[model samples]
Target: MYGAFWRILPGPWWIRLLIVLVIVAIVLYSLVTWVFPWVQELTNATDVTVGG
Candidate 1:
């Protein structure tokens, strides 16, 4: 699957690497900004205490 993705990207090696890095950055940003916070709210994990 990864091989197919690399093959599908159109560019030299450096350009392809930059594209992959940008995609990764966007995914991480969305997770941190929205997805993780939503999941935290749903789970209400902050109030839990360990061995208290």
Candidate 2:
């Protein structure tokens, strides 16, 4: 899968590396800004002792 992605990207090694980094940053930012919050809401987790 990753091999296919690298093959599809149009650039030299350094440019491809930069593009991969940008893609990773965008994915991480989206998870942090949206996905994680939605998951947390679904789970409804809270801090509390399970037993005495």
Candidate 3:
């Protein structure tokens, strides 16, 4: 699967690396900005107690 994706990307090796980095950055940013907060709210993570 990864091999197929690498082949499908356009440009030389350095350009491909740059594109992959940009894609990773975008995914990480979205998770931090939106996905993680939504999941935290759904789970009520801050309300959990370690012991009682």
TM-scores of the models, in the order given:
0.87, 0.89, 0.86
lDDT of 2: 0.94
Candidate 1 clashes between residue pairs 3 or more apart in a chain or in different chains = none
Clashing pairs in 2: none
Query: Of models 2 and 3, which has the larger TM-score?
Result: 2
List residue ranges in candidate 3 displaced over 4 A.
Answer: none
C-alpha-based local distance difference test score of model 1: 0.95
lDDT of each: 0.95, 0.94, 0.92
Sort by TM-score, best first: 2, 1, 3
Report the lDDT tens digits of candidate 3 across residue range 7-37. Answer: 9999999999999999999999999999998
Please give, for residues 17-41, the per-residue lDDT of candidate 2 as tens digits: 9999999999999999999999998
